[model samples]
Target: MTAPLLEVNDLKMHFPIKSGLFSRAKTFNRAVDGVSLSIQPGETVGLVGESGCGKSTLGRCIARLYQPTEGRVYFKGNDLVHLSHKALLPYRQNIQMIFQDPMESLNARHTVGEILEEPFIIHGIGDAQSRRRSVAKLLDTVGLPSRSATRYPFEFSGGQRQRIGIARAIALNPELIICDEPVSALDVSIQSQILNLLMDLQQEYNLAYLFIAHDLAVVKHISDRVLIMYLGQIVESAASETIYQSPLHPYTQSLISAIPIPDPHRKTNRILLQGDVPSPIAPPSGCRFHTRCPVAEPRCSETAPSLLEAETQHDARCLLINSQ
Candidate 1:
């Protein structure tokens, strides 16, 4: 059998905190405690969670934007966790990321053409004329007119700027693109446009996506598999249909119940979660979701439930279900 395109094992990203000058104390914020997943060629894995659930951090770690604190990230059968900066360059081209805000990610001073061509220039892929031609083609490929390349990011609408970001991400022909809330910054109408564009681009290029977003509806529309996150840990993961239809984790159930249905006439229930997400600096002792989990039991507060596949192909980190 062929190996997965990308595999992550026990990944963690922690940020240190400094206390008083004389005190000898080490404190760290667990942005990503322990995350492990894999993506195959042309697969779309949707990561869905509430704000500040470490979804973006996990994506960044996969793209190597931030070096992981611990664990291994293997891409194309090579471990990337310990690769030197120089050695990692080739892999950088293989994996790219699309940020949540296009305006913030794209340089305002650089023209759209320059922004798209920068990848080719960095990798030394083509000459000046060829790079310019490639930039124009990228614009056209992303549904923008060739002339739009001459404009700056601030000049375009939110959706258009995101398209530019998408164009740049695919310019390198990356095998995997970590989309970090790429559509959350746009308007409702424009969000669909960007999502559709991304889908079309994936079909054309056979690109794999680590699609991160807060909107379950959007994830349902695009993802083959969906992962539910809470407080920097994966609470549940399964095929998109299975996750929506039969969520075992309370967190997953709450999240799925919250997706707004368009039909006002159709009656539906909403699971309103109690309390805000706990601080990542001092997460709960056992299952992180136990603090807010509606159906949490006594064992939920003492022993952390491992991510186990109780049902066929469905993994949940909840004590209520049988472990793998």
Candidate 2:
């Protein structure tokens, strides 16, 4: 079997909060408690969770944008956690990120041409004239007009700006792209277009993607494998079809039930979770999800459950599933 292109083991990202008069007393916000997963070459893994579940934080940690507080991030068997900024340059070329808001991610001062050429310039890929030619080619590749190379980002629509962002991400021919809710800020129609563009790009480049989003339907449409996260931890993981058809964890069931059906005539029951998500700064003991789980028993509050294999290639973290 082919080895994974990227592997993350027990990664954590915690931000410290200080409140004393001297600001000496500190509490850590456990944004990413412990997440472990892998992505094969050219595969797309979907990470689905509600808002404030640390999905974006986890993605940033893997991309080395935010140095993780603990654990290991291995890319091609190289541990990235300990690499300094100067030492990480070579690896940065192979991993790129697409932010959710295109305008914010793009520089207002730079024209499209300059933005696209920046990567080549940083890596010393080509001369001035050659970089310009490459920039024009990138514009065409993303379906933007050559004239767009001279235009500012504010001149284009939201979808067009996103296309430029995608162009920049692919400029270095990255093997892995961390897509942080790339389509969440666009119109519904535009969302499909961007998603299709991303899929096409992946096929053309054999790129692997860690697709992070809150929309279950969007995840189902694009993912080969799906991971359900709650309170900064993965609750269930399996093939996309298996996750949609037969989810094992109560948290996954509630999330799956929330996906809207396209057919108006078809009716489905919704599994409504109780209580709000607890603060990550002080997450509940035992199962982090037990507070909102409808079927949670007393045992759930007393003992945490490890992620256990429920079937071939399927894993879930729940005491009920563990008992079976």
Candidate 3:
């Protein structure tokens, strides 16, 4: 196999949980706690979990948009975690992020052309005339008319704004792009179009993707590898087909079972998870999923299970499954 384009090792991002009459130190929300993975060049790795599972936080950390409290982010063998803001600029062009909400991500005041041109100016891609030429090409590449470039973000519809967001991401021709629910906001019909656009772009640019989403169906469609995260930790990492066909961890099983089947006659085993995800501020001592895992044993609440490989490259954090 080829060397990974992006490797995240024990990546952690903790937001301080402060609470007091005058605001004193309390605890921390362990958003991404000891998470690790890698993304090969031109491959798509999907990060799937519930809303507060720190999927988006991890994406931002990978893109260097948020500084991780602990752990290392290596892009093409370069350690990004230790790099200062000034030093991180070179990697910014190769790693871009598409936010979940197109409206919030794009500045309402800036025109489409201005938004796309910002990266060129920041990275010093070209002077006035050349940058202008790049802007027009980007607008057309995203399937938007060049005339739309002069219009503000508010004037465009949701899908159109998302297209603009995608154009900006590719303006630098990034080697890796972290997509934080890129198509979740749009209607179902528009979702497929955006997904197709992303697949096409990946093939055209040989780009890698760290796709963060809660929707398993969408992830299964785009991801070559899938990581199942829970309570800020990855419980399962395997090929997309393996994870969907034979999930190992209880959390993974439940998540897989939750995916709706298109066929009316197809009856599947539903592993419904009980209880809500534990508070990250005070995560369970050993296995964070023990609180809700139906197959959880006493050892689950006492000793944590490390992610161990099964057949080939598949891995999961579960004692019962691994022992089998």
Candidate 4:
């Protein structure tokens, strides 16, 4: 069996929230309580969940953009959580991240060429002449004209800017790319273009992607495996087709049911979740999803369910599923 290209075990990211000015009383927002997943070389794993479900935080932790509060992030068997700046530099080239909003991520002061060239500069991969040539080639690879290298991010459309972001991410020939909702801001038509471009790049470079998004439809189209995340934890995980066809966790079922069908005449059963997502600073006891889970039992409020394998290559964190 091929070894995993990236592995995250019991990852957590907590931010302190201080209320009193001088009291020194602080509480931590448990953004990502405990997440454990792995990605093989040349694979795409889609992480689907509602906004503020800690999906982005988890991605940043894996990319080492945000130092995790707890747990191990192993890339090619080396833990990244505790690596020093100099020691982590080499691994930075192997793992990269594409933010949700290209406009915000790209530097406004720099031209597109400069933005794309920054990666090679930081990694000491090439000289000025070679980097310039590489930058132009990257623009062409992402379906942009070579001339785009001279332009600023604001001068281009949203899709074009995203293309630039993609170009920057691939500049280092990374083994794993954490795509944080890369298409949620683009139009439907443009979103397809970007998604297809990513797929093509994956095949060309054998790249592995941790694709994060709220759209199940988008996830279904690009992902081989899908993980369903709730408040601050993953409730279920399985192959894209298997989870969509038969979601085990109630949260997964609700999310899957909400995907819009193109056929207007076909009847759809939408599971409307009651109540807003609870505060992550103080999430509900036991099953973090029980507050909004449709079929939650009384015991769900007391016993925190463990992520257990319910079948081959399928896992869920639901007491009901475990009881059966």
Q: Provide the lDDT at 302 for model 4.
A: 100
Question: TM-scores for all candidates?
Answer: 0.97, 0.98, 0.97, 0.98
User: Candidate 4 lDDT, tens digit per residue, 87-147?
Assistant: 9999999999998899999999999999999999888888999999999899999999999
Q: Candidate 2 has what TM-score?
A: 0.98
Structural RMSD, model 2: 1.0
Please state every model's RMSD to the true fold in angstroms: 1.5, 1.0, 1.3, 1.0
Off by over 4 Å in 2: 20-22
Tens-digit lDDT string for candidate 1 (1-324): 367899999999997777987865598889898999988899999999888889999999888889999989999989998999999999999999999999999999999988999999999999999999999989999999999888899999999999999999999999999999999989999998999999999999999999999999899889999999888889899999999888888888888787778898977687899999999999998888888888778888999888888788899888887542
Better of 1 and 2 by lDDT: 2
Q: lDDT by residue for model 2 over 115-134, one digit each (tens)?
A: 99999999999899999999
Off by over 4 Å in 1: 20-25
Q: Which candidate would rank higher by TM-score, 3 or 4?
A: 4
Tell me which residue pairs clash in candidate 3.
none
lDDT of 2: 0.93
